[model samples]
Target: MTSAFIHLKASRLGRMAAACLAALALAVPAHAEKLPRLVLAGPAAAVSVPLIHMVETGALKEVADSVEFVTWKDPDQLRVLALGGKADFLAMPSNVAANLYNRGQPLKLLNISTWGVLWMVSRDKNLKTLADFRGKEIAMPFRADMPDIVFGLLAERLGMDPKKDFALRYVASPLDAMQLLITRRVDHALLAEPAVSMALRKTKSFPISVVAPDLYRSVDLQQEWGRLFKREARLPQAGITVLGKAMSNDALQAKVMAAYEKSLAWCQKNARQCGEMVAKRIDLLSPEAVADSLAASPLRHVSAAAAREELTFFFQQMLAKNPALVGGKLPDAGFYGNAGRP
Candidate 1:
């Protein structure tokens, strides 16, 4: 065909292509960029009770298009989810978060979910302080984890070597340690709530038939931490963190934070109901027992910025004890969120 004829046919085809593109554009939905699914995970602990309540209340419906909430009874499972990039939002021990962040992970702490749940519970009435365990048998669990690390810090602060000053019988798990306590194998145990509450309940059967309030003298180490620091006395325990990918979306972050706080508020307001829900999730204790423990649980939702001083102090203590605890050093300014919203 002649050049002029070929050019005329090409122009007609171009016009037809433009017409088809316009028609397709008009047919497609306006919000075609489907948002990615978000996953929030934590252990089945009281600190995570609020998140569970949030999931139960459909709090994330306002923010997330699709969210999956998964609870693990083991911290290691939660750790894998948090560190392996399997979860978008996760709750983990503050020290683990700090350590991960300091080691150059893109994890950022959103807020403090748990203040301090660790308690020093003992069958001996005289076992009051760290001084009391100078040469007594004590049970410890989850080696190098928060409980073990915290106890080490407490011992060092009390001017005693944990190994030499106290006979700490390390157990495989907190439940194992609690078993030792119930059997009266160890006079003292460093346990977290749920575990503390569980041990207290077991006392009703063995070791003592009569369960008095003073059967096990307990001390809240969060208060002790506050006293030791002489600053923020509350124990800033585990909290929620988001990988860089999830936090890249500012709107999503705000929604997640707000939903979290709202869920936590609802649980705080309806303690008994929340505890029943939590007990169902944990299954280690009854609803009434869980409710009572949840009410007494030292769970809090402090924004990272408001909690910086407390966090820095806590991390510093961990670092002083062992540089590896906080990943050799403290995290940078970016580690703390602008605030886990209002």
Candidate 2:
């Protein structure tokens, strides 16, 4: 009778286990179906290369059920998407993210994609330092943009006034500056990646003959920033960001970050193919130029939580430069999307 009772108890336990399993099986599909559909916005720049690779390789499939992508024509479109809540995630400039966060936008950076791609391209052979540009003209693009911000800080540190020490000839875009350089209208140009590559490709002295090669030996601003800020370990350029509304789900966020990280690795491994995609998808730059700019773009993927210290430094520096640049003050702990914080 005891053995029979034991058998009956075992049967009851098995039935309960089966019932629980059936409930879980029924819930998983419903939960998955309910997962938010993620819309990702990417700007047409080298910064979006990794996420582009993610989209191409179906890496996002590992995290999201359905992901729609919208390629932005310019930075303003990105701002519109953020303000309008049109996208759940976006890849944009790091400083822009900081500025937005400080302005009370519910934005949280995910990871940095590009370390630094800005370069000072000029024909000036004796262009040794910021002081050398005194009384000279530079083809500076995006008047108060990232490149200009860095230039201003470095010039001031060197005891020079950026506006007065160097004549900043502002242009509508980097391509315009490149055209100016080619036409011998400007001797120096501060160009971001892909633009630098494009300028090198379009120069008369490239791939066939060397005509005007002032853009030949461009100074990498990433290295320059490091040299100037000796205490900082990272350059922390631009990165991917997610809406604060999306960060509430830790599992989804982790999966997304993992997918993005994998995508970054894949991008580095298959730059040539990814460059072709970047060129064809958005017409941002030529395929050849994109391929060459991949390495120098300094693509990195550091989660916002892990990057807080360096980001704080960068934002604080910008705050020091112009209170408006970082929206008056450094962002609080809530600004980041780290597991501990969010």
TM-score of each predicted structure versus truth: 0.83, 0.83
User: lDDT value for candidate 1?
Assistant: 0.76
Off by over 4 Å in 1: 1-36, 205-217
Candidate 2, TM-score vs. the true structure? 0.83
Residues 71-183, candidate 1: write the lDDT tens digits: 75555776677668888888888888888888878888889978888888887766667777788888987788888888888778778898898888888666677778876
lDDT of 2 by residue, 209-298 (tens): 354664564566666677777854337778778884675776666667777777677767877787887777665477777778886677
Each model's backbone clash number: 2, 3
